[model samples]
Target: MRITELIDRTTLFDRILLVFLLFVTGASIVLIPLYLPHGGQIRIEVNNKLLYKLPINEDKTIPIGGLTVEIKAGKVRVADSDCPGKICVKQGWIDSGAIICLPNRVVITVEGTAAAPKGVDATT
Candidate 1:
């Protein structure tokens, strides 16, 4: 593609689209992992009792109804939580590879021989 030709076709919409796409691409690189944690799992443990498990990852983006969570390499937190706490929801995206919600009885812990962060806790 010729630089001059590319410049010539540049319109407001084109510029906007280009900028938007760039922002999206850049953000996706970082955000993709959080929305879907790399644990290969969606486990539910009730009072130390194993409830259930599902295969998932950082790209899977476990959704808790109105809440959105981004799983990282260590712990998972509520990227968005439908529940009232928003506390778990607003923990600002973590991934010591483990995320758990005491209230909802929801637990997400990442485990795949992957690296874990120094200090990550889903409960906090």
Candidate 2:
């Protein structure tokens, strides 16, 4: 039978309770992410080793090996690198995701307050 038929068979209080529960579930799904704090720092790594967990709020330039990462106004970009492709530099500034240079083995990731996965040295 249809879900509406089942609801119709229930008493008024039961129907109201079910509706309230559904509303709560839906609200939580929509609001939880909005309330979660955005990541305030950039996690930099090279060859799977933690390099830096610098705050994105302050503009800075970091030189990790042959790669130069520039952080400005809460965003980061691969300003320069010795890698041949230069794909990492072309990716542009980003507030999230990652800017990875395979040749130089440099990785920059933006994360929220959530902790990085276990065994991963990238997040500090």
Candidate 3:
């Protein structure tokens, strides 16, 4: 009827296994983020064409059409844009994923060595 009663009914071996599993889960939560790969480069595309491939380590501001992209401290963001909604500019700095300015036909993506393998569903 109660959690304590259920736990008390568990054998010593079961308790040990539960503790081990908890430890493993905690370790995974802490360690997984550390091992995950970080973006190494920023790719800028215009009109579905590759426009620039810049290193994430270097800080720079790029101007394309009416949009201004700023990269700083290994992060990239759309600092300014002429788009009506300003959604891209509001998205702020990002270390991973992409920023799209639909009106300007611009897309910015962060890429790294751990990119999805060829022939695999990257979205997954």
Model 2 quality (TM-score): 0.61
Per-residue lDDT for 1-124 in model 3, tens only? Answer: 9999988899999989989999999998888656644668888999999999999889999999999999999999999999999999999998877899999999998888545577857596
Question: What lDDT does the true structure give each of the candidates?
Answer: 0.60, 0.84, 0.90
lDDT of 3 at 25: 100
lDDT (Cα, 0-100) at 45 in candidate 1: 55
* TM per candidate: 0.37, 0.61, 0.62
- Please identify model 3 stretches exceeding 4 Å from their true place: 1-37, 114-124
Give the per-residue lDDT digits (tens) of candidate 1, residues 63-99: 6645566555544556766666656665565443456
Tens digit per residue, CA lDDT, model 2, 46-123: 899987988888899878888889999888999888989999999998886788899998888887754656774756
Alpha-carbon shift of residue 105 in model 2 (angstroms):
0.5
Q: What's the candidate order when arranged by decreasing TM-score?
A: 3, 2, 1
Give the number of the best model, judged by lDDT.
Answer: 3
- Count of residue pairs whose backbone atoms collide, per candidate: 22, 1, 0
lDDT of 2 at 102: 97
> Model 1 off-target regions past 4 Å?
1-58, 72-75, 112-124
Better of 1 and 2 by TM-score: 2
Cα shift from native, residue 80, model 3 (Å): 0.3
